[model samples]
Target: MDMSSISRHEFRLEFLVTSLLFTAFCGYGLVWIEELVISEHWPLDEQRFWPGKSYDLNGYLDIIVAGKEHPQYGRPNILSLRYLDEVARINQYIVHNITVPVDLEGKHYEVAYTDLCMSFDWACYLNDHLTMLMPKSRWGNFSGPIAEFASDIINNEVNITYPIGWRGSEPIYFGALVGRPHLVDREGHFDHATALRLTYNVGNISYIWRKKLASWLTNKEKPPSGESQMLSETAAGEGQAHCCLV
Candidate 1:
């Protein structure tokens, strides 16, 4: 073989060995690196939390075991006018585009002005941000269902009864138990000011819930099972929602 060819062959062999050794060194380094752990004092004082950041949900585990008195994520209630504007202006199209998973316990209740107002608000907010990828909005174009549900609510065809007074006449509701998945943006980037705001954990839970609900709407699947307990006095308030996110 020519001297140049011989040199090229030798260089190729050396490069392969060096590459293999580098990868092996990296693998060893990873095993020895210390892992990150949350501070033990996290739950005692929520000051350790990051605003609009989704931390481990283990902090709120007590609610799962709290039993009846503990409360669901928040009480269901009327959708505010501000929220309605969000739907028309922002998240409406977005929510209709994706799917979300929620252990929806109660029947898909009819809409009162309160219900439409709240969910429409969320839909609008969802549409504004949450690109078609990642945390993409998933509320489907169920105007028909919504309209029908609204009519039903108007006519009192279905029971407007949610034993939980917190959940008065709102069309949409959601929560997380102890260690399930959550669906929140936690960035405080979304327009929850108009819609009902939630804490970090609550927002995290809502993010997942909304996503899943969006997916279900996209697929036209029936709502999932498992019931959600309640929490807090006011319900998905903006500041409160951001808090739970962390």
Candidate 2:
């Protein structure tokens, strides 16, 4: 008797259900797309690498060894210090009050040098940038911990020792290892100059972005078990410290 009424009620219920389902699917798709874009935006994989302009970290070990062996420039050492200044200049850029945003393992970090300096103490022109970030004081005032912390930075691991205020008489040291390395000639002579010329204002944004994307994708595809290993060397020069944004 009321067949027309029943049909109308069923059509309304069906349309409402369909609309709700469509809305839910659209919302989920938007979220999924956003995440995908983010993943592509900041990849944190270990397999990616972006060489720095002006001074690519070429021959870093040689530079450290040279800085240790030969205090004076133009002196013949195991490694050549001819191009060390260029690299030092680039490292200086890291602390030039510029900020960099980095994404590692799904964590967002804004890295900027809050404070830094260049010290030529201990008979070597060490980029003493990291010294400012060292913890003021610690339970033990030893050099071993300081050395280890520097190693972690060179190795590209986040192991900075940020203690409270300054520790009296407990100086922290970080050896320069993140810049271009010193090269040497076969005849035990410091080369007059380097083959590559450096220039500031390079295209670093796209370069860094590509690297971050690669790193992120690589990590998602294959997670890393431990800290990254970078080519490094030790020197007798005065140690320097570097700081990173939280």
Candidate 3:
């Protein structure tokens, strides 16, 4: 064959190979993106944990519980709610039953209201932000199967029969207070107010909390008072602190 013809034939072969490689890369990229989106929006069948059925909380001592880990490293299929009445009742019971420590006397000790309020605000902000991305109805409501599924879960999990006494909204207060010590450190004094103030400008608090929960579960072991239990709680708490500060 002549030089011109041989060069043309080689060019065509090169173009064909390059085109196949480019197409394969694009296809793989699309599939990866789709998998990531699906994992975030939908829970895997194997990781769908129901409280009474798949897992039992009776083994744990703490009132707040963490769900099973997500298979895809995405969002876990768990709903978190702070029951106002139930929390109040528990606080009241603790105040009446437990004696105050001598060192904490005369201090204006209070619940971690700043953290609580911030958490609530973050949740509201996230909801509003995500809702804007979703399709809505004429009545300013989210519409679709995902919305319906979320509504059903919330309704089933939350006890709406509780009485409501307050109507007006209150201003969010942010300040330091003598509050409960760190869960993992009984002797060490680390209040929520200080923690919140330190981590205020850091990353999302929700993600930090989730990381903490995951650490807690992974490090948890039999016999709550065991070394492993303490290590787990410490790891989780440390993760929250580090992530928040970072």
**Per-residue lDDT over 124-176 for candidate 2, one digit per residue giving the tens place of the 0 to 100 score:** 22333223322323223446768777554444433222221122333322122
Q: After superposition, how far is residue 99 of candidate 3 from its true place, in Å?
A: 20
Question: Candidate 3: which pairs clash?
Answer: none
User: Global lDDT of each model?
Assistant: 0.30, 0.33, 0.31
lDDT of 2: 0.33
Cα TM-score per model: 0.21, 0.20, 0.22
**Residues 1-246, candidate 3, lDDT per residue (tens digit)?**
699988888789789999999999999999988877765654332224221122211111122212233467532222112222222333233223322222246665333212222222243111121121122231155558777866664444322111111112321222121112132243232222111111211122333433433443344343211221222333333223321110
Error (Å) of candidate 2 at residue 78 is 47
Q: Which candidate, 1 or 2, has the higher TM-score?
A: 1
lDDT, residue 211, model 1:
34
**Candidate 1 runs further than 4 Å off:** 11-14, 20-47, 51-197, 200-246
By TM-score, the best candidate is 3
